[model samples]
Target: MSKIGQAISEIQTLENISREDRWVNRLHPLGKLVLTVFYITVTVSFPKYELAGLAGMLLYPLAVFTVADLSFGDALRRLRVVLPLVMIMGILNPFFDREILLTIGRVPISGGVISMLTLMVKAVLTVLAGYLLIATTPMDEICRAMRVIHIPKIFVIVVLLIYRYVTVFLSEARRITQAYELRAPKQRGVHYKVWGSLLGQMLLRSMDRANDIYESMQLRGFDGNFRLGKKAALRPADFLWPVLWALVILALRLFPVVELIGRIFV
Candidate 1:
């Protein structure tokens, strides 16, 4: 209904994907992390011009999103926030190389266009994979996974602090936005210039809140780093599922029967 309500709902949907309950959620966060990394590695390893390979790479993350009860639509919508930047970075490719690579009817397509298309696909797929990973795995588990993988303590501490504070800042942002809408009834366009002032105020408030949180943590005897109580243990199912998926990914990548057939027929 309300903008604030919608934002909260979207965030909740993105953050929680364990709707099925038991088994999948119980898998070690490290396992999920490893699988995600594997997917990205294989996807990007293909030649940039291999459209078939790039398209095929979508299967893994899509299937995972479906089975894990993740929100594909919501993730795509969130991705729109950064798509403009991606497009800007890619725009120059077409201009730099006008050499004809292919033709449809009378119009010719250049290598630049093909490369740009590949870049866009890779960017979107990788980003969506990352979002799906976090959506299915909680932040606490991710930090614990990083530690288990022997990531440095300082990096883990920074990640944990960011995770904790980002939400605090988001809440503050939502409150300020709501307050602005209420105070300025039906205002539009140039009137929103006041956001600059509001932004500065919010920054000051955020700094104060961060200081208070630091003091609170110190009082609780928080050492320089966090230690998760116990690492998540792997179960038979956890080990089996990821391995099976990895095998499937590898088969499709190496074999690519569908692409072979397409090239032969077309």
Candidate 2:
């Protein structure tokens, strides 16, 4: 399949995963959303050179992946895009921070090298935390969770619209690509010279598609408020998971859990 087709398929697969009868999907969206936010915050709060503590933070994603029964291979494949961006973000850290942090046997390890590794680990774990939420919770459920917590009505609606539009725009672009490929069968992907015109045309097509989608929504009486399927009650028991995980996360963040564990082993 073409790259564009593969991209569309990946998106659909993610949507399917969210709707699957997985363990994580079985939980209350609010619980998952809240804990996800807390987890990311804790992960990001670590100091750049605190690599050991940051390494221990991998427990969150590992726990999520194990509970959710998500595929590790698929997770790594998805990381390809993020890996480049993360490297670019931290590539210069080594040069900027040349402080001799410590000596490993003979060679000195600088603060920049340590911090760069820390930043990259933080980036991977944070991204994984987010996708774990998406893997288990549908976009609508997330939006509903936000509303339940008293987010502004207009903002909720806007979020839903943007999420819906992504699929619509992707569909429009895919169709355009197919037509271009049919006309220029010899070319591999869109030519560089045509990128500007192709994107401009895509913009026009997207706007028209958006208008059609809006009209359809209006015809279906889609008021600013979304009406989702009758969600099961978010029970008191539902709060247990997030609360427990959050406590563990907080403790790890405030205290040196990694060092304590290492001391015990040593």
Best model per lDDT:
2
Candidate 1 C-alpha lDDT tens digits along 36-93: 8998888778775666678877887888777776677867876776778878877788
What lDDT tens digits, residue by residue, belong to model 2 across residues 3-88? Answer: 76787788788889999997678789999999999999999899989999987788888988997789767767777888898899
Error of 1 at 148 (Å): 0.8
Clashing pairs in 2: none
Residue 228: error of model 2 in Å?
Answer: 1.7
Each prediction's Cα lDDT score?
A: 0.77, 0.86
- In model 1, where is the ten-residue run with the lowest total lDDT? 14-23
Per-model RMSD to reference: 3.8, 2.7
